[model samples]
Target chain A: MWRGFSMRVVSAFLIGLLFGLGLVVSQMINPAKVIGFLDIAGDWDPTLLVVMAAALATTFLGYRLVLKRGKPVLDASFRLPTNTVIDRPLLIGAGLFGVGWAMAGLCPGPAISAAAVGGPAPWIFVAAMACGMQGQRLIRP
Target chain B: MVEFTPLSGAVGGFVIGLAAVLFMAVNGRVAGISGILAGVLTPVRGDWAWRAAFMAGLFAAPLAFWLATSEKPQVVFDHPLWLVALGGVLVGFGARLGGGCTSGHGVCGMARLSRRSIAATATFMATAMISVFVLHHLAGF
Candidate 1:
């Protein structure tokens, strides 16, 4: 059990490392770049669209091929999202998230990754985000 | 377009896809940034360990990169402090209520052909574009 737990932790770290590196290499961590992608009426950047397409294409093939196997390599079963219905909360919540992302040009992943290399600004954003999350638990719970 | 890097974007995206695949294969987990961050904050038994490790690796990767290459991600904040904080709050709340964000719905979930993820991805992306339009084109914000 201990061995399995350690393996999971180590692999998780490596995977996270790879992800962060991808964000940096792709320059997704740059707010100017992301916002530029959003600035459609202005000088819009299509680079992000290509990045998303490349990721989607690769993962589309990857998931289909991998799921054909009996089960995931490490776990007993594949853990996948089962929710299918589009509801109000999903819509409203997504709208809010989109607006927020546009305002700051940092999603959760980029925020954390940015904080690793930055000053107090990212931390403040993260702290505010935490409070918002905690507020959700309180208000909705 | 202000600036573009097609090759690096595609290559980085490919790396991200591979990391997501490895994460799902070995850990049987979705590499959703919001979900993982929320999980760490909520802390259900036996679940927080991997989240913690993954987050640690997020920071560690940039640190390692800086050590090796003397470079880090470049981020700028043009918004007011209040707006930035509010943006963070909305992102946190919205991601929690919406169920996932770019990594989950946009990349991993859409790739899997999950209907709900497809819907969520569309909704969030649309809103993101709209928000950008309103902020930049309409209001010059």
Candidate 2:
């Protein structure tokens, strides 16, 4: 039991490390780079497009191979998202996220990763994000 | 205009995908940053441990890179503190309500060819582009 728990924790840490490294290396942690990509009406940067395409392609092939296994190594079943309905919450929420993303040029992954830099902005953003999340729970729950 | 770095982008993206695949293989979990983070905020029994470990790793990546390379990753925020805070709130709330963010919906869910993810991605991407246009061009911010 201990072995299984440790394995999951270690694997998760390593994977998160790799993901954060990718964000840093790709310059996705830079708000300027993200804004440059989103500002198509201005001096648009196509780098993010390449990044997205490459990520999608790699994940496309990688997930296919991974899912072929009957079960994960440490877990009994894949905990994949099962909700299929493209409902109101999905659209509204995505829309809100998009606007916020453009306003700040940061997403969840990069935002959290950026916290390592130890600045007021990232921390403030993260703290506000936490509050917003908690607020949502308060409202919904 | 932002400097284009296709090679680094692709490499980083591939690494990100690999991490996602590895996470799924070991823990059978999607590497969704928002969901993982939300789980951390609201701890559940027998969970949250791996999530905390993963977040810790994410927080460590930039420090690790800086230690190894003596260079901190660039992070710039053009928006004001209030705007950034508002954006953070929106991102946090929207990601939860939407059930995923860029990493979950854009990367993992799209890779799996999920229709809901596709729609969510489309909505977010389009709105983000529009928001950028408005902010950078129309509003001249």
DockQ of each: 0.73, 0.82
Query: Model 1 off-target regions past 4 Å?
Result: none
- Residues forming the 10-long window of minimal summed lDDT in candidate 2 chain B: B76-85
Clashing pairs in 1: none
lDDT of residue A11 for candidate 2:
88
Interface RMSD of each: 1.4, 1.0
Chain B structural similarity (TM-score) per candidate: 0.92, 0.96
**Candidate 1 chain A: 10-residue stretch with minimal lDDT:** A23-32
* Candidate 2 ranges with C-alpha deviation above 4 Å: none
Model 2's CAPRI class is: high
Q: lDDT value for candidate 1?
A: 0.82
Best by DockQ: 2
Q: Give lDDT tens digits, candidate 2, residues B9-112.
A: 88888878888888888899989899999999999998989999999888888888889999888888887888788889988988888888999999999999
Tell me each candidate's TM-score. 0.95, 0.97
